[model samples]
Target: MAETELVCANRECRIAQGGRCIEGHDDLAKCLYYGNEPEEGDQNEADDDQEVIAPFNGVYLPDAHPLDSRRADRVLASLPSRMIGVIGVHDSGKTSVIAGLFDLFQMGPVANIIFAGSSTLHGLEIICHDARAASERDEPHSERTKRGEVRFYHFDVLRDGLLQSLLIADRSGEEYEEVADLAANATTMFELRRADVITVLVDGRRLASSRDRADVMGAIPLIIQGMAENGAFSRKPNLAIVLTKDDAVQASTRKDQVQRDFLAIIDGIRDAFASHFGEIGSFVTSASPKDANVVRGAGLAEMLEFWMKPGAEAQGIRQHSYSGRVFDSLMIEEAKRG
Candidate 1:
């Protein structure tokens, strides 16, 4: 490391002589362009740490698909990681939030967090495609999580100068509503049982409507009670009551009223369930909002930071052993009878 070394090995960045960074960074060393150029015979060394996306022999890597619980275990076994489980009703903006976080990384750092890499790059890109201008859609739309079993999207990020692994579980919101309908259904949500953070989303658009608001808000208590009875919070993970589609609420004429209602729900949940969780918090996010007035990814960075918090430490390895779908119809029948 000599003063003569160019930023990121770029010849034009004569930083030793005070040439500015190509990316306008004050310190050339912090610039993306500022790194050692791959030295001769260095490709093999770099591949060794390639987020396990490296191929078996340069052409046999695992498909970049969402990780199942088993696959997720293999990754967790190798790296220190945090698991976040997102639960909500239909169209609650789960996929949009996940896709928005991915889109933010494409532009550059988010909240000063560096995107190191992802194990499910293709899967992440697929969810984000329709929302991008590249899709040639007149209006952007998020791809909803397909109704099925739970799957995880893995991201390796460098935050606060340290590399950390994040595993965010994605499941159809309809499926989560089923758990709200029957507490016993929660037993099948192994992801939540294993989660370090469990985020509950309420649709901000619904919050803006007087008629629809009650149904939407009422579901929160039912979902939490169901999960609690099923032992989903046995480990006491951090609980987050997240309001999605803040843009919708902002556009409503009763914006102030809606915001207050949302805050009231957060406070009520805290008072009611403080003992059931390790920590309880709330967040507002407007990920991939269609309203032009709303900053496209507003509040997502803060939401991501919350997920990255050292909340309820991760529990021991997950013990779910489902063959196909984790949903157990027999358990639901029993719960109904009881």
Candidate 2:
């Protein structure tokens, strides 16, 4: 038969130029569509034979899961836990501090606290990924943590051969601000209430600057007042007022000047919340230290020792804890010296 005169047996085939199928099969016998046309009974059979693929059943993985309160509760149910909650305003260095604490225990033993393991290794990797990358590139900026999410970084530490579970809450500065502003009613507030130790991070670089000191100092009282209003201080959680970015402050000014600045901020916190709580411990910390290429958690170990174990070197004058009356009197004495 001539090419044009020839017709495909399959009704689904569109005859192109010649006797070829649209799929480029020229021979009628070789064409996939040739005898594949569905008839009345064939349609039902084909439909019945078709296998349906199920949705993925193995597992779903994320870069990191935000340790919300529910996940924290579940995690705590599995272990004997001590909760350390970090509080700060936006860019006040709460995440960096938590990452530093992780690095400290992960790298090696500190003050006889051996690095055992962690349940949320992926979560730690996500939080520290940028800072690790930045260190390699010699970049000035570290990663900013996710805002408004309260994440828990888990750690198993062996202190003097005794294993203990440590849960540190990494919350954004905005979350703290919300509570400070009396706006937060979410799970974060409850997390704060449950915290065994609450550390308030004050940006050292900002507090060191004359122009920023007033605003920074002014915000401290409001946050303390807000926490007090929300009953965070009702149980009198162990308070640590951590001055972060100490490296930046030291690089820009004299050591004595930085000490004065540190004292002022601590005094401000003391004045604001002293009567509400029994004792407060203040420390200067640098997550990214000057001599280290990576985060060494330089000042974190001391802070941890002070809160976790009572009689480490943190019991000295630098990490001293005092009652409300004693702290107020010290503040008065320091004010007279200035």
Which candidate number maximizes lDDT? 1
* Per-residue alpha-carbon lDDT of candidate 2 for residues 231-272, written as tens digits (9 for 90 to 100): 665556678889898887777765566677678878877776
Segments in model 1 whose C-alpha atoms lie over 4 Å from true places: 1-58, 313-338
**C-alpha lDDT of all candidate models, in order:** 0.83, 0.69
lDDT of 1 by residue, 55-126 (tens): 566566789989999999887777778889998888888898899899888899887878998899999999
C-alpha displacement of 332 in model 1, angstroms?
41
TM-score of 2: 0.69
Per-residue error for 41 in candidate 1, Å, reads 52
TM-score for each model? 0.74, 0.69
State the lDDT at 9 in candidate 1. 53
Worst 10 residues of 2 by lDDT: 309-318
lDDT score, candidate 1 = 0.83
